[model samples]
Target chain A: MAKHEHKLEIFRGYLKFKSNVQKIWGVLIFLSIVTAIEVALGILKPPILMNYFLGLKLINWIFIILTIVKAYYITWDFMHVRDEKPFLKNTIILPLLILIPFLLFILLWEGSYIFDVMLDGLKEWDFDIY
Target chain B: MQASTLTKTKQKTWGGGGVKPLDAAYGKLMMWFFIVSDALTFSGFLVAYGFSRFKNIDSWPIADEVFHHFPFLHGVDAPMYYVALMTFILIFSSVTMVLAVDAGHNNDKNRVAFYMLLTIIGGAVFVGSQAWEWKNFIKGEYGAVEIQNGEILQFYDIKKDKRIPIDDFAVLQSQERVTHDDNVGIWYQSEAKLPEITLSEVMEGFKTNSAITVRVEELNDKGQKIILSREDAENKLSSATRVVKGANLIRNEYGNPLFADFFFFITGFHGFHVFSGVVINIIIFINVLLGTYERRGHYDMVEKVGLYWHFVDLVWVFVFTFFYLV
Candidate 1:
């Protein structure tokens, strides 16, 4: 009985150590490789892919997504949120989720308005701007 | 009964030290909250920029042509390469930061310190590169013709249908300069100088010289610049070029003023953030080397600072996209 207890304790200790190492290395490797891939894509900026998107360039989307991925990993893993409870994570992320879209929408709406003004009116102005 | 009551009272006392809300180490949670606020600030700036961009859709200068400088090779229309390099530097710095965090986890103090140093250096280099970019932007390109009202009028000869330089025409300075300064008079309003050559110079030149062409901002049915043949440009230039120069609101030799405004404000703001980030990173770097966090048996200090550094990188990603890519 004593011997069995000792073996179980040893196994648990080893597993705990291994898990810690894996968690640390897993995030590090993932971030490094992803960053490398982004750099490569940016350098290449292949026009074939760029043209496929409807007036939206591939380079822009790639940078945005890659940036999001990096932010997600840094916040979740390196920042040790993986160990955090769900409620805690929600507290941190919830406000951002609500605000980001609202802000973007306002910008887009207002931006479109400004574009219309410049295009529709300014171009037709007869005043001589020598 | 009294003894049991005393023990219950002791147990009932609030155990305030037990697991705090959010279950995060204090430093990490605070860092996260800080990032949230910082993100909001950047979003505001970007949204405002977007609003401006949308407002001037037709005349909004194309981004590609404006940032066409390639280092060591002048006039080699290389766009997006330097910004691409800056992006790589930031991302690499982010990698080093993660490595430092990893080293901290393994209790590899030396490795953590080394990686942190590299990150700090990377940030410094990125800021320096940004400064260089600003220098190029501030120093105007192919100086344009200035008017009395500080308005700029760019010359596009109708005969040749190309943008001409102020030097192309024989310019004469105004003799009756508007001098109101205390030195010139008791009430000094500095005289505004108008371009002597004006648009008519090109027009008149083209009327005599048949090779000039004029290209206006208005696009044709094919979406190309509406070009006026020598005869049409000569006719129009003679009539319209007579108007006194207002402000160069349209495209000019130094590129576009709108571009200058955006370039100065957006990149300048971003550079300010970077400069401040570098300063803060240096403070933390010194702290790390001094064994401030090491003495605590927890490198949480480094991790907190890492979050700020990464946040800087994150903002740059957006700036790079809007400033260069978009």
Candidate 2:
């Protein structure tokens, strides 16, 4: 049997806790802050952030980025992935990292193509069948 | 001499495979694999949802308008508020689950049991909220008329800038209409419940009410639903075929039927996961109370179930983003 070590440091070791309970509260506060920001942005939906950037609203980009940050904290801190061996961490993350983007690309591209065919390219086709 | 030969043969067959590659217990590693596979399954469903949304981008239902109901706030428009609260509950449960695991690490059985109880409560609350949401979605607020071309036309009052239910303006008809029950229709084929108001009644009411305007599903340059002109509204209403009161797998008062379909499938699947997680947590909590892990000298069972609980929370983050926020 091997002795397992728990990583008690967070925020790049800036907020080191002597006890696990303290660390748990720290991560909870951090996650709550991030979620509050996300909810606030969702409710407000400011026009400035609604401006288009990279084919999406800037606010949308903000939401996505903030979500990723929250996910990372949940995985690394709450799930204790940070304490796992590097091989284990990579084993879990690598497959999803590769697959999600590939799936997104295919779905978005094909959807747009179908939209064009239905709405613009084939206007002569009658859609008014009861 | 015989023992040495047996050892050699055993080594040859087994290849010294007992070493844990990543220092993770076998159960924990298997849980990780399951989580990965499950994550892919969810991603597949969500990507499919993305495809359908993109295909009908212009007419897609705005999430804010569709999910506006909040508990105890009758007739109030609180978009994304309840869902945000649900997300927080799930995340907080994940926190408690990890805390339970942490307690297990310290060999503190009491703390582990307490935290596990909290986690289960959180999961129950979240599942209940989701069911309520589904109910609201199925029993829609403002009903729409489905035209001949399969497009939905919802009504809005110009002065209020809000959706008005058909019940508010629809004129009651004296003619009797019966729903097609199993006996009325074919024995094996039965029809869904009919809407409260008939199409002719809706048209008559619309003709009389000049302030009510039709909002088409199509989005304008600003990404808002387009309001048809009075003449266009009259023209479109002339083609009305059926009245859709709410959402189902087949049709929805909302613009795209596919949106409702995807909503049911994806969220239903995720809800199932949360449900199963709660059951598993309860089982593990009972085992902890029975001192099963304490007697075994390690609480690896709690840690493994914690992995599952956290994965559920992780999937929800994506769901919240894709379905509600983005």
Candidate 3:
């Protein structure tokens, strides 16, 4: 068995907790607030955020970014990934960083291409066998 | 990694190894990798959803429309509220789980057990909420008509500016309608159970109705489903095949079958994770009550499951964003 000490600061050290239990409560409130914002945006669906950016809605981008931010807190704080050694941190995250973005790019690009092909309404939308 | 810590083993063969290479116990490290792999699998499902949705962008069902029914608020237009509540419940469970880990770190037996109990209750509640969501999805509220080309055409009231269920217009009678079972189909190709209202009934009902209009799955420039004129609705209804009541693997009252498929698969998979997390927590809770970790001088098991519980929460955030909010 080894002794473990948790770094009791979050928000890039802007917020600090004297105890682990307090930090856990703080995170729960923060996460609830973020989710509330997301739900509110979803319900209201402001016209300004409906504008498109890079073929996606600006509001959608905000939602995805907020989701990522929530994921970060859940992983780094709740899962204690922040306290892990640099080797462990890089190994865990670097693979996901490479793989997730690559897959998203390839699949979304191909999906859009398929959409274009289907839009043309040509019966034969298949690519060449080569 | 420091040079001083990198001591070369005197053995002839190099076995690149650290007892806790991932900066935790081997068990926790293995759990981390398991989570990473599971995350990839979930991402694959979601990306596949994105692919199908993009390909059918003009006709993909609006998630808010499909998932509006909250637990007791029947027929109420409460979109994203229930799922939001489920999200908060799951996140609060994750908080309790981490608190359990922190309590275990202090070797506080009573607190660890208490938090673990709360965490388990929270997880069970979240799973229950998801089951309710699936029930609502499977038993769709606003029934639609499926035409010759497999596109769903929903009915709307111009005055109300909202969708109307098939039962509102289509007359229900004691007709001898048989289920489309294996015996009834050509070449024994079984189909879903027969819907309540037939195509003729729907068409006739539409003719009698004055305010009802047909909403095509195709989206207009404003990203709203196109509501066809009465004459055009009749024109499209000429090719109507059957009345779709609810969602199954084959049929969906929602716009696209693919949308239903992804909804079931992604959320179903996440719900399974929450279920297993609760089971695992229960097992650990029992062990904590027995003072297993206290006897062993540490509480790494609590910490490992905390990681898993949090991962479940993390996945839900993404699922909520992509499935509902997006």
Candidate 4:
């Protein structure tokens, strides 16, 4: 009888941990707080809020970091990545890790070229009064 | 042959449990993998958008002026408020979806149904709001002059300190010189009505009115016209009346052409996702109601759809930031 009761307790706990409304509520509240902070920072544009400890513009860096955090949580909790195995997780993230950086690099390179072109054309880009 | 391939991929366990190391139940694993790939796609688009924005760093249109609309408040320059509200709505719906998933785990059918209904409503409302936003943008508020060079030049009333009508600048209306192939010689076409107040008329007005300032695209930032110093405005007005061919790529009367392009592509893309998401959600909602999961003894399907719904919300968060706020 005692063994049976212990087994029942473990099962109940497993069910609760696997899908608990309260835990989901906690995640929701935390996400809301983070979103509010982002909104406040975006609107206030606080001076001296550096993203890097040394030289980087803190606002842009912070935004990127916060976005990554949100992405991580959405994957882990909402998409249940924690329940997934190491091999499966690696399979999914490996491609993204390579592709996203490559895409950003290309965009930056092309964008700089366009910027130079626009700057050079400034002499003729000006308006004509007729 | 397919059976052999499946068995070959399914590795035998040391203890004879027969479960693979990388094995996860289909829905949960697929959802995670799909989200990962979708995230990469969104990041690519946004990074490209950022690249374009950086290229035009000096003269990018201000987010405040472009998306300056609020519900039930006309002509009130409220920026980011509506989009902010939409963000909150999406997040709230996400909360409800997660809760529904939780309820499903506990086998609480009633709670799951209620939350699912709420999520559907939130999605529908978001789609409606987006339609309204598109309508306001497509039917522009202030009318502008369509120059011969395919460029739009906005108007300003010198005396009223407001946008003037193209009809107000009319020295002579355009007479129809050619007819279309469809209506050739069938009916006499009338001339296009010209602005009532000509450039010379505007120049005369600017000279007399001390407060009047004429802003030109080439002269203004982002190629948008604004009232400037009275003397400078009058000087611009005194130039020759013959309008030149203005380029539409740089700047135009409807804010900026680039802004229009981004607005259509990004929002249209996001809206397409929302539409498809809703359709998918409806399908799954029906499945849930029919007790398919109840008989299956697992509510994993609900969890999968919840992931998709949350993803739709996630993309909106970035859209709200870049499109409306930044």
Local distance difference test scores for all models = 0.61, 0.87, 0.85, 0.63
Worst 10 residues of 2 chain B by lDDT: B1-10
lDDT of 2 at B249: 94
What are the fnat scores of the candidates, in the order listed?
0.53, 0.83, 0.87, 0.45
Q: Could you give candidate 4's per-residue lDDT for residues B101-147 as a string of tens digits?
A: 76777777878888888888888888888988877766555444334
TM match of model 3 to true structure: 0.91
For residues A1-130, could you state the per-residue lDDT of candidate 3 as single tens digits? 4666788899988999998778878888898888889999999999999999999999999999999989998988899887889898888898888998899888888888898888885656546423
Q: Which candidate, 1 or 2, has the higher lDDT? A: 2
Candidate 2's residue-wise lDDT over B1-326, tens digit each?
A: 11111222343323124555577776677889999999899999999998998888878899999998999999888999999999999989988998898888888899999999999999999999999999999999899999988999999888787778999999998867777677765576677777779888888889898888899999998889999878889998888999998899989998889989999999999999999999999999998999877866677789889999998999899899989998
Q: Which ten residues in a row have the lowest lDDT in candidate 4 chain B?
A: B1-10
TM-score of chain B of 3: 0.90
**Candidate 1 lDDT tens digits, B47-102:** 77776766554445555544667679786767777777787787678778867876
RMSD (CA, angstroms), candidate 4: 8.0
DockQ-based class of model 2 = medium
Tens digit of per-residue lDDT, candidate 3, span B1-326: 11112124433222235444655676777788899999999899989888888888888888888888887786788988889989988898888889889888888999999999999999999999998888888888878898898888999888898788888888655677677677765788776656667877787788888789999999888789999888888888888998888888888998888888888899999999999999999999999998777866677789889989999999999999999988
TM-score of each: 0.70, 0.93, 0.91, 0.72
Task: Estimate the overall C-alpha local distance difference test score of candidate 3.
Answer: 0.85
Poorest stretch of ten by lDDT in candidate 3 chain B: B1-10
Off by over 4 Å in 1: A1-84, A117-130, B1-19, B145-258
**For residues A24-110, what per-residue lDDT tens digits would candidate 4 score against the true structure?**
565666677777777677666687763345323576567667666666665556555555667887887788888888987888778
Q: In lDDT terms, how accurate is model 4?
A: 0.63
Candidate 1: tens digits of C-alpha lDDT, residues A1-130: 0010111112224433244435445555665676566656655667655653643456667766876776776666555555577898788788988998899888878778766765566764746754
Per residue, candidate 2 scores C-alpha lDDT tens digits across A16-48 of 988777888888898889988998999998989
